[model samples]
Target: MNNPFNPSFGKVPNIFLDRAHAVTKLSTELQNPNSPYQTTLIYGVRGVGKTSLLTDVGNKMSAKKNWLVVNLTTNYNVLQTLIDSICQKSSPEIKRLLDKIEGIKLSAFGIQFEYRLQELTETNYQILLENILDKLQAKNISLLVTIDEVDPTPEIKNFISLYQLLIRENYQISLIMTGLPNKLSELQNDDVLTFLLRSARMELSNLDLLSIKHSYQDTFAKKGITISDDVLIAMVKKTKGYAYSFQLLGYLLWEIADKKITLATLEQIQGEYLATLGRNVYYKVLQELSPVDHSFVIAMAKAPTQVVTTAYLQQKLDKPKNYLSMYRKRLLDAQVIKSPARGMLEFTLPYFKEYILENLKFYV
Candidate 1:
């Protein structure tokens, strides 16, 4: 059998685990005509599966007959990308409508047309988009715009501002954006994007160990493989409930093991596993953090124990307790660290503390 596991970041697994509820919630909202979640943001650290979740939900959403899912990336001009994606739709009806409005034949055959009227030659994006929406909504269709790894640039802000206007006019549209906490936080500071603050916030948390273990066991068994109980437990523990690691471990193990999982195989892939996490998650996360936030991570790393006291963090940074609060909050917001107890702190990402220690000189 071909490999069922997909380790590449953002590739949705054939069998997704630990996020059914969020998917169900999004599905319900997509089907509902009036959903406050129309403007949704899925925020998480790298490898926490924001993209996977977005893909899953977008898939479920686009399955409906009246819904159009436009999956986009932040690589290009956001507005132009949206326009290109919409125009690039292969649906016969969508192509027909675009051609009818633009007075240009756009289809697989070839582009051939001229303006039937002088008035049709000049059309703005807003008018063209609104006309497209009007045509779709007239047929009781809704648009679902899903953007992965969203960057909150001026272009994105402009897109949000325009989208907010569409919402005010009661357009049948929904937007789903996935991004790191730091980039998402930038949206919160933009006055134009204030409408987005009211949208549903689904922060990706660590997958539960129980969910991870059951999924691994069931998926392996389906492929005619039986993993020892201890190996299953060890696999889940090593994954630390991170979503990408869940797939990464399974992919690595499936390659080496014949019919059964072994500890030796687990030990064999340990270094590549860590290096993958560093390349995929750690570097991306640190690249987005400000200097102050890096200092906060370094200070926390210097603490003697994993559970560092808040007071100790302040003293180590040689800053007043109140002054240190900003960085502390920044780290907490980024999900790099969590307040385990009332006053205790610890890194949330598995092996993050080690990654920090190994790269302290650069960050400091």
Candidate 2:
């Protein structure tokens, strides 16, 4: 049988955990004219389901008759891509209206449009987008733009500035963006993008342990397989309630287990599980950190408890309290580590300490 669990990034899995609350809140707010959620930002660590949650919310809104959802990526001119996406998804009547605008020609190749200009200025792009929004508004259609993996680029800043203007003009337009915490922090600090600081921020957290357990039990039962309570709990604990880990462990378990799961089956996948996570998530996470940030993380990894005290870290790194405090706030803003209480810190990703310990030589 095909694997029911999907460990791939950005792809929604067959047996997904229900984040109905987040999905509902965003979908409902976007439909409301006065809701502040019209512009929402979702930020989280890698593989914590930021992209998946954004996709789910977009899909929910797109199902409505009056909603036109357009997904954009940061790899190109965002404004041009927005126009192309809007035109592609628009109805035939709306397409004709947009095509009638001078200098904007809709290509016969699936509604992609070309602007007759050597270079499109910010003002020019805004005017073109305003014209299109006018057409969409005439049909009483609300536009929802979803951009994944947002970064602080000139293209993004330009698009966001225009987006703010469109919002002020009271167009039936909304934007939802997803990015890593550090990337979002960078965007938030941009003077031109200060409007983003006011956006409704949703920081994705780890899944509930109970929820993860139930999802596993239900999924295994559907496959006519049974897992003892002990073995099931052990498997769930291994996932650490992180979304990607849940899927990865479930995918591995589904492939190796037969009609019944035993502790032995769980034992078989341990090496592969940790190794895969290191390659897919941890390595990339480390690459994003600076040399000092590496030292901070390494210091925390040496703590006996998952939650490390600030005093302990200060002593371990042999840095002054003030010096360590700067890195503490930096990591907090990056969401690499979170403070569970005053003068304490902990890694946001599950099994991160173990991953660090296993690869200590390279990091050192």
Candidate 3:
């Protein structure tokens, strides 16, 4: 049977686990133009399923009556790209509105019809989008803008500003974006887009262990693979409740398994695929940290035990409690680390501590 595990980013998984409440709530909000979550920021470190949640929410909303999903990419001229996307995916009724937008004519033709159509400027992309939004609003239709991989880019800032204006005009639209914690921190500094700070925030975290266990078993059984309970538990433990690792482990294990998945089958996967999964998911998370946060993380990794307290970290790094507190909040916001108690900290990703120890020299 083909491997059911899909490790690629942004692609919705075949066996999605957890985040049901959040997804359902966001889906319901699509019908309410005034939902506070109408402009939401779904953020987390790499491989935490931010894109999956964002995409799933968009898909659910698109299925609703008279709702449209406009997905944006990190390309030149975000406004122009948005204009083109709305034009392309819009219903015929909406298309009539987009057909009147000016500058987008130059963008849509991409020099192919430059001779027939006069070159136009994109300064009024907001006007174009507002016209489209007003037409849809009249028809009682709404638009949901889903953007992935947010960064501190000029085009993105401009896009946010434009959205702000449309919101003031009461166009029926919602903007959902995903970004790393640090990138989002910087983006919020833009005075014009500072309103994003008030937007609802959904920080993606690891899946529930029970959710992973059931989803894993169900997916495997459907493929005619008899997975023992012990092996199933071991697989979930190795995945660390991360969505990406869940897919990676299952894909590798299925590649080598016969009709049954035994304890032996789980053992067969450890040497190479396990390390590959760690590097793919864990290292990228480390890169997302700021230099100070990275140093703080390395200190926690070198600590004597899995759980470290703020006092212990302060002593280990010879820093003040205030300094540790600041980085702690930063890491927590990034979802790279979690606080299990009043002051105790632990890495959120499974096998992450082990990975840190093995690469301490380079990271330090």
Candidate 4:
């Protein structure tokens, strides 16, 4: 049984309803006459289709609104990349104007550099921005620039600064950015950006239970499979509505789609593979851990609720365990799990918890 929803894997067209709603709202905001937002920030956990929704919005807006879209994936030299992006689509007169300027012919990494007086100064950037924007406006072309990875650090700060300047100058440009939620707080604190970010914050939270259920049902229905409610609920509970987890499980379930899935067949997974699939993701991360760290995780797996205190880990590892402080840091660095507040941690990957518990049941 092929998955009906599998086509959407790693593709933008398969965006779910919940994510579509978010994109639609932003689109509506962009086209709104009364209170249009100049900049939009979309924040969500990894693999929640932030990029996909933006792609869908961009495609639709391109057709319906004739929007000129510029998408920038945050990478090295992002600021200059943005400058090049603007130049690529600048008006012929603007391009001709930039071309006549001296020291503008140089290309780095296969991109032509544009030389304009205001390109140098923060003050002048605004003056130059108004000129370019005026030209763009003359053509009745609105711009929607989507920048993924909203971290307000080095690479992004430059773009943010320029955009903030444009906003102050009242340029007619719409911006949509996606990144980790933590970065949103970072932007909210910036004096320059705070005023500009009045009401354009869109948070992409996890899918609700009903949405997840609907997604699975739709996927199975497309495959001509009738999944039982109990099996469907089990899958949802194990995945906890995490997008990537749902995809991975859905994908694997499809691999076994020869017949209708039953609890009995699910229980027949070879050896501990099924029990450990839930935990394998965690240990896949764990294999990268040091021996001491690995032992500590094994301890946590054996523990209830998958929670471990520093003292508990110390006792489990049989050393003073203060030496294992680096272990926690490394685990976090590896994104295995995170401490919610302090003194408590949960598996970042849900299936890992079940994997660990199953290991304890079989091996211990």
Q: Using TM-score as the measure, which candidate wins?
A: 2
Q: State each candidate's clash count.
A: 0, 0, 0, 3
TM-score of each: 0.90, 0.94, 0.89, 0.68
Of candidate 4, the 10-residue stretch with the lowest lDDT total is: 1-10
Best by lDDT: 2
Q: Which residue pairs does candidate 2 place in steric collision?
A: none
lDDT of 1 by residue, 124-215 (tens): 55666776777778778888899888888777777778888888888898899998888887896687777777888999988999988999
Model 2, 1-364: lDDT tens per residue?
6888999988767766757788888988888899889999998888888888888888988899899999998876777778878888887888899898765887678544355465466567777889889988998999999889898888888788888988999999999999988888888889888988899999887789889888889889888999989988998888877889999999999998889988898889988999999999999998899999999999899889999999899889999999998989888877678888998788877788999988889998
lDDT of each structure?
Answer: 0.80, 0.86, 0.79, 0.63
Ranking by lDDT: 2, 1, 3, 4
Please identify which of the two predictions, 1 or 3, would achieve the higher TM-score against the true structure.
Answer: 1
lDDT of 4 by residue, 59-78 (tens): 77767544567778767666
A best-first ranking of the candidates according to their TM-score comes to 2, 1, 3, 4
- Between candidates 1 and 2, the lDDT winner: 2
lDDT of 1: 0.80
Error of 1 at 33 (Å): 2.1
**Candidate 4 local lDDT, residue 308:** 66
